[model samples]
Target chain A: MPPLPVITGLGFITSIGQDRATVGRSLRELQHGFERVEFFGNPNLPVKVAGTIKGFDFPTPSWRDWRWPDRFTVDRELLRGLAPHGVYALCALQQALTEAGLEPGELGDGTTGLFCASAGSPFMLGSFLGQMRETRGERGNPMGVVSSIAGTLNFNLATHYRITGAVCGFVSACASSSHALGYAMDEIRLGRQQRMLVVGAEDMTDESIMAFSSLRALSNNPDPATASRPFDRRRDGFVGTGGAVALIVEDAALARRRGAHIIAELIGWGQAGDGHSVTASHPEGAGLREAMRRSLADARVNARDVGYVNAHATSTVAGDRSEALALHATFTSQGARPRVSSTKALTGHGLSLAGVMEAAFCALAIDEGFIPGAAHLEEPDPVCTGLDLPRTSLAEAPGLVLNNSSGFGGSNVCHLLRRPA
Target chain B: MKTSAPSPTASTEHEQSIRHLPAPARAAFEQFQAGGDPATLDPVVLAILADFSPRASEIPLADLPGDTMLIDDLGFDSLAITEVVFAAEDLFRINITNEEIVQVRTLDHLRGFIRAKVAGRSAR
Candidate 1:
């Protein structure tokens, strides 16, 4: 059949770390990235903590001046109109392209495409609403209009890079980026595009935090480090967070021809809709099971051959339990149950960004031969107990890994990644 | 995340300029003036200039010559010029129509237009 798509470059920024090396190191050191909410701290709110990126200043004049080199000069002034998610996507894409040694408009004959996933522009909407209230909607920031669009990230990146090929945006909630990455793989496999950049970005605002708090879907634990304990008995819910991740994906032959450093082989991708709930996952995890099975089947790899499973366990009572049931049904029935864990335990739930970040984590794990432990995972619940939820880093790398990502709308996406030979 | 627009720091002289401004403009300008450099700068004017200038370009805002042309000297494009006007409107909480914006050429001209708007508002 067609050649497998490979990841040539990876760039990610999260509460855990900014780059792969640093994130891997942090994982090994058992350093959790969650911290007290910096934006909003309502003492009465049930959730008081999040996986916040401390002092995150992207495109900030002073921050960029010191951090970015002259060659990477960007017109920060022009970007002032973009939403935070848009900025995060552009920054992540820049890093990925730089690492891949590609410049804007240099993607070889425009066969390059872009796929972006975002949890809408909540931050900009909030700011715009406030501005509208203050200005009585008569006068507000002109940029407010651009930032309010959900496709801001996709449109901004495509225009900035001049990627004249297919540009698409996916809004599958938490599974959004996973769907983006999966579709990018499909395009390459279908010979529709030679290269694609998959991006996932999110901007968590006080409104989002309050929304989750209203739903009682956030962890009430005041401790940032241990608040997001996936699969643990004490787990309450995911800690809200925001960040971005980008992956430069290309046809395996094209990547090898370009002599790009192949990070991992994206072998399979599967997506399914549970059709069960608007906000909650299916208790039986029927959709998740189908997604995993489809992913393995698409990869043409046996379930027994899989080495690790990056679970979409958000630490909520129903979410984690449902994911565990899906995992047990998908991997356990087959011989050699793969080790399963959720990096969300450290990075928390970055909404639309969660999928791609966790997928990137799997790529890093394969590249470095280290599987990160599910941080703060103590006293695993009986329903999730059978799975090998290692609390410490696995020194040896697995040959293949499965990344499971699901969203509020019962959208589930699974990706199978393999170590590049 | 708001774009890191150059916030206008009202100087003592800038604050003095507010006295001549109308009540609405003075109130708006005072908010801009709060917690900024006390140097003799008309922050509103300086902010409008700085917003349109290139980030790395050496455009000295503190001591701008009154005769400097916005285009030839500062290299502001059409869009950049529009952004300056928008920023001004947002800061001063005043409505600057497109027709009025086109007539503004120099930094001094723009400053005069703002002063006129504030004075016009006070007359109401």
Candidate 2:
């Protein structure tokens, strides 16, 4: 039998924290990062608050990093065109590669692959449109097209890291990164690649926030801590935010040979489409339930053996109720109930990064021996009852943790992870 | 046709080089130089052309002919030309739309387009 794929290196930047250790601490302490929307705020925009990473300091290329004097001109051009999401992905990629002890040349291995997820480059699109308006359509940046593409972040990471392997980007709205992670694990498990880097990065631009506001899919509450109240009766909508997460999955044996720190074993992954609605999810969460069942079966673990679940609750009325119904059905059918919580309450449903960051949190929980609670989940809606929605962090080591992520167009993904033995 | 000599206001190296070009190209350069609008100034055109030269790749900006077809002579694909248009927009503070780019077939056409745009902006 083929060895299971395991996450050997983890790096992420969220509204809550910039690294695994920091984010893990925040998760354990139930520290919420939602605050007033700083960059995307507009009086006309319905939602006034969002989760944002305050004081994020991005890195600049040094003389040695760019191999200056020789490739300075080309390097400068590339740097000039990088969008915010690309920068975040590159930063997280650097950290993950460093943690995996893999250099650029090592990433060039034929068996290494990259699977990245992003919804779109809102910031780049805004810049392009601004240029168009200011110049009256006369001229614009040549790199705008490249920067605005949805696949820009993945392409940049692959080219920058010199990884010539299969590089792909997933765009299933909020489920994008979960699908990326799922496909990456399949690639490694099926012997298509020995290692893969899964990345999820997104930026909250004014355009995105405004669009969501128009859709009434954002919280209007002014209080930062209570803005994203997943499972609560007064829940309004998700809090938009910018976030990124990266994980290096390698063949378990390969990781063991390299003495890599195995965060957790990626036991199983499943994806499904609702096929019911273009925008709204199925009323019963059919796709979500199927995804979880398939994931649990693929892992060959009983539902009773699963100890925890990190939900994709985005703090919306319909979204939370649908997910709750799905979880109750899936767990009750198996005659076992696992503790469930939505870290989105803290991270504010970071769209593209939601699944990947939640996966990162599960890996951290495996190492830290604690599961974070659903922050601000005070008055759980009666519809979202029956599951153990802990209001405080639980000091317990779960043997298996399931992360459920769903998105617009009714896409759903479930990734099953196991504690490192 | 009376071709005016290079303008006194522009003493850049590009202007000096333009004076030696054969009649038509040098006349066009003189007309652009005498316009006095910063958008159609010699330095701005040269900078845009310089930025575009690398993208055009086949010929250097210095040897570029005024009537050279964008795709035929300069080897610019649609995406490549889009970059050039963007560069031109930034350099001259003008906007060239997709439709306008289609009408621009030659370097001379591009110069005329810029001159007309500058004239319109000045009239505004």
Candidate 3:
């Protein structure tokens, strides 16, 4: 039998923390990183706060002018064609590769692959096109389209990191990174790649954030503490956050041979589309339930053995209820009640970034012997009655974990992971 | 036009050197210089192009010669030239076509094109 696929390294440049140590502390302490920002200088952009990042200062849109943090030494010339999220992704990759003990030449192995996700850099896109409009389209930025489109991360990362093997980008709205993670795992398990780096990020500008306000999917809660209460009865809509996350997945034998620290085993994954609506999910979370069931079957693990479920509930009324129904249908009928929570309650929904970020969260839980609880969950919605929704962090090791991620167009993806044995 | 000035090499300069200035740009440069009232181009164009030059870190922008080849000496690709053009457009508020600038090979050639475009803009 082939060696199993396992996550050997993790890197996070998130609002919650820039490194695993800080992230572990934040998760253990149940603290959140939320701040108010002027959305494109407009005071009235629905939500008032987000899980915002504070370091790696850039004085201008030109990346050459950026003052990178001390931990990350950058070759500024390589950043000329990258967008904001692309820049964050590169930094996250550096951290991940360093943690994995892989040098540049090793990462350049033809057997290695990179699967990345981002909704593109809307901030850069808006600025690029807006400038073109002002110029009457007579002139164009040389790097405009490359840096602004949904494939920005792929273009910038594959080129900068010298990835000689398979490189791909996933774009299923918020489920984008989860899809990337699953595909990366599949590539490794099938022996197509010795290693695959799954990474994702998004921009936090008004252009990126306010684009969702018209859909009425943003939290209007003025209070940051309770704004993203995932399963609470008072849940309105999701709060947004942006940063980057990277996880290095490789053959378990390869990792052990290299003495790499194995974080968790990526047991199985499943993806499905509701075919029901463009925005609203299936009323009964039909596709999500199918995804969860398929994931369990793929891993060949009984539903009862799953110790925790990182819920996809993003605090939206219909969304949370649908996921709850999916959970109840998937677990309750089988008399299985795994501990459930959405760390989005702490780190605001990261949109396209949620999948890989939350997957990294599950890995952290496995390694650190704790399950992140629903940070602000209170007064659970009636739909959540049967499912186990822990309101506080548990100090016990979560033996196995399933992370669920859902997005627009009724796309659902679930990844099941187990503690490294 | 065919009279050899000792160094009038045969074959079309257009087809010969992607690195060196083509015949048209050289002709344009000589024509403008012969006018006696040489145009005083702004420093902004040089400032912009210097940033895009790949050799800037070693040669330094101030040391690059006027007749220095942007492609060969300054090490600029087609995309880098386009970026230089974009910067010039924003600075001079004028438009330049790819066909008009693709054959330009030197800083002087670039200056001549910008002088003509800026003059045209002023006339408009």
Order of models, best DockQ first = 3, 1, 2
Interface RMSD after interface superposition, model 1: 9.7
| B1-124: candidate 1 lDDT, tens digit per residue | 2222233434663554344334544554566456332221256566556645645357565467776777877776666676666555545445677777777788777667777765564455
- Scored by DockQ, the top model is 3
Kindly list the per-residue Cα lDDT of model 3 for residues A66-161, writing each as its tens digit.
655787766545666777777678788888888889887887878889999999987778778886686566545678899889989988888877
DockQ score for model 1:
0.17
Q: Model 3, range B1-124, lDDT digits (tens) per residue?
A: 1111122223343223211233444454345435522364334456567566544456645466778888887768877787777655544456777778877888778878888887886676
lDDT of 2 at B26: 50
- Position A108, candidate 3: lDDT: 88
lDDT of each: 0.76, 0.76, 0.82
Q: Which stretches of candidate 2 lie over 4 Å from their true place?
A: A38-41, A57-77, A129-138, B1-124
Per-model chain A TM: 0.93, 0.93, 0.98
Q: Please, what are the lDDT tens digits per residue for candidate 1 over residues A1-421?
A: 4867999888866778776677888877768787776445456666778776554543322112223223333465546556655656666777788878787768636799999988677656776778668545553555566656677788777777777888999998889999999999999999999999999988755754557777789888889878989989999888988878999999999888888899899999888889999999999898998998899889888889998999999889999998998888887766567888888888889888988998888998898888888778879999975788888888988779999999988999999999987
Superposed model 3: Cα runs more than 4 Å off? A56-61, A64-68, B1-43, B53-59, B64-75, B90-124
DockQ of each: 0.17, 0.13, 0.18
How well does model 1 score by local distance difference test? 0.76
